[model samples]
Target: MSETHALDQIAAWRAAGRKTALATVVQTWGSSPRPAGSHMAINDRNEFVGSVSGGCIEGAVVEAAREVMTSGVPKTLDFGVTNEMAWEVGLACGGKVRVFVEAVE
Candidate 1:
C-alpha cells in the first residue's frame, strides 16, 4: 500500500482508540527496497501494513512494535544485513535501514 494510505490508517486507528504503533523507515542505504519515510503500522492485534525493507526486516520490526505497544515506549531501531543479528531477520543485501517506532495515541 501507499505510505499515505498507511499513515491514514494509523491516524484512523488512533482516533478509534485502538492501541497502535507506527514504524517509519527514517534512513536507508545501498539497494534498499524502500526509501526513507516508508512506514508500517501495527495494531494490538499484530496486524501490519506497509513495509520498511524488502520483506527482509519486517518481522523484527513487528516484534519491536509489539514491544512498543505493550510498553508505551518509543524506539529507534537500526538493521543492517552486514550485522549478524540483522542477518538473522533475513536482511542479507549489505543494506542498512533505520526505523523509528512509537506508540500512537
Candidate 2:
C-alpha cells in the first residue's frame, strides 16, 4: 500500500486509542527492495500495514515490534543476512536493511 494510506490508517488507529508501533526503513545497502522512509504500522493485535522489505525480513521486524511494545522502548534494528541466512530469508542478493521501530505516541 501507499505510504499516505498507511499513515492515514495509523492516524485513525491512534485516534481510537489503539497501541501501535511504527516501523520505518531508515537505511538500506546494496539492492534493497525498499528505500529509506518506507514505513509499516503494527498494532497490538499483530496487524500490519506497509513494508520495509519485500517480505524477506518482515517476520523478524514484527518480532522486534512486539518487543518494543512490551518494553515501551523504541529501537532501530539492523538486519544483514549471511550467504546462508540470506538464502533462508530470501534476500539472496546480498542486501542490508536498517529498520527503525518506534512505539507510536
lDDT of each: 0.86, 0.82
Superposed model 1: Cα runs more than 4 Å off: none
Q: Please, what are the lDDT tens digits per residue for candidate 1 over residues 5-101?
A: 8788888888888889999999888877889999899888778889888888888899999999999899998888666685387467777888999
* Model 1's TM-score against the true structure: 0.88
Clashes of 2: 0
Q: Per-residue lDDT for 1-100 in model 2, tens only?
A: 5787768877888898787888999998899899999999888778888898888888877888888987889998876765344654546556888899
RMSD of each: 1.6, 2.2
Task: Superpose all Cα atoms of candidate 1 onto the true structure and report the RMSD in Å to 1 decimal.
Answer: 1.6
Worst 10 residues of 1 by lDDT: 82-91
TM-score for candidate 2, please give it. Answer: 0.85
What's the lDDT for residue 28 in model 2?
A: 89
Deviation of model 1 at 89, angstroms: 1.0
* Regions more than 4 Å wrong, model 2: 83-90
